[model samples]
Target: MVKLFNEPIILKCDHCGKDLFADSQMSIIVFVEDRKNKVIKDVYVCCKLECDRNLQEIKVKEGLIDGWKDLSDLTNPILFLNQIMATFNRMKNGWIFEPNAFEKLKEIYLACAQYVMREPTESEIKRASDILGLPF
Candidate 1:
């Protein structure tokens, strides 16, 4: 998942297509498929918080609210990755992060690298290296 964010890519509101930047007050909702795969279903950016709430209600009514959570709550990288891989034996679409959320993904990858390097087994080191696409 090599996302090129070289330029200032303006993200849009998933519902209204309004221009949104990284610093905007936005809400990101991820949909988890069977507790194994996660996909960003929407990124709601609105001037009023009520608009974002309204959109979320609509999604709930449409049954698209399965395993949804606030992006801010995803603070634990290892736990987040574990949940994404809980039922799946192999990695899949859940491993991907939305382009706007690339910074968070980088942080998680870095955390994973640090974790695995802390008194890691040979095999664990290799696995982490492979996952991070780094030559260890």
Candidate 2:
């Protein structure tokens, strides 16, 4: 009798909340860089249309595109707020991040410490709460 082999899960899909196996054809990796600190962050998602679109939207909204890459420096207020919301969403969805992910998250929060340390305005609170199902 032959025994079936099961692939190990490497990570979770940031969009669909699904387990990503070692060789999932649908897996895609996106990098979010904190150029000011020379740090690179990774975002994992499946290659489904909705998932891909959501990632693209986040990039666009965060202004991480080719010419606007400086927007991801973590100093921009909008970018900082968005990153915090994204982290929150990931935690809310029970994503088990790797160690480096934690380090990057720590770097991000530290870089934006001033913003976090201060009182958030009513507008900021409203905008942060308005996560329209985008997976960061």
Candidate 3:
């Protein structure tokens, strides 16, 4: 799959009639879920305030939580950015992750971020393994 942060798409909010997205800015994050209700995959975006509010309302109605992690974990934006970039590299290098691998990686980043706040421990390693789908 060719992942390019390209042009934007406009979508309306279920609550209000408004342009939810704009071109060349940010697109709406369209994420997919699996049969078991696990997040299968996700895509990021830039959207309008109404759309954000609408999504929150719907998720609230369904009692769903946005599991997206903080992307500001890594101090250096370049290295932090490389985390997602490396996933694609690994895919091309034959380390293609499972369908929901990116989501797991996001969790891994969160774990690492927490580790950065305290003494590193074995649990962090376990989390890393789990994110990579490796047996502990």
Candidate 4:
């Protein structure tokens, strides 16, 4: 497993709804794809080795892994969100004006708002709301 990020991120297992600390060794992130090679879903699991194996087998049987990706290391959501915001700001300031700019910025802003609102930490939610100028 490649270490993509050093900090831990909160995630919930799609199958069991169990809280998963992405920095934990037992955590697994799996991406499922259809036969045509389009990604369909992403599954996060924090479980024992046996459970991980079982999930892989089940997904294989369902033909959801024609070309799949598995990663143990994940980026912290807050950091990722901050990066997104920074990139959006840079683009807003540097890029030529486009008709879709408003829509694109709105999309990113709404994504940040939703993520912070759903975050488990109150501090994170409040800070993100304040930074994004969103009333939560």
Judged by TM-score, which candidate is best?
Answer: 4
- Tens digits of lDDT, candidate 1, 2-101: 2222232343555666643332335443342223335443333332355466665665444344343433223345654664465243235344445554
Cα lDDT tens digits, model 4, 43-88, are 3343546656767776645656623222232244565466556546
Residue lDDT tens for model 2, 1-136: 0111122223455677664333345544455544343333443344445776776666534433312122123445676677678767866765555567576456435534443345556665556657543221
> Each candidate's lDDT (Cα)?
0.43, 0.48, 0.41, 0.46
Best by lDDT: 2
CA lDDT, candidate 1, residue 118:
36
lDDT of 1: 0.43
Question: What is the number of backbone collisions in each predicted candidate, taken in the order shown?
Answer: 0, 0, 3, 0
TM-score of every model versus the real structure: 0.32, 0.33, 0.27, 0.39
lDDT per residue (tens digit) for residues 4-101 in model 3:
11222233323454433323132233333332343333322224455556565544334334433222333235655665575567557554334454
- Which candidate would rank higher by TM-score, 1 or 2? 2
Model 4 RMSD in Å is 11.3
Worst 10 residues of 2 by lDDT: 1-10
Please tell me which model should have the higher lDDT, number 2 or number 4: 2
C-alpha lDDT (0 to 100) for residue 69 of candidate 1: 41
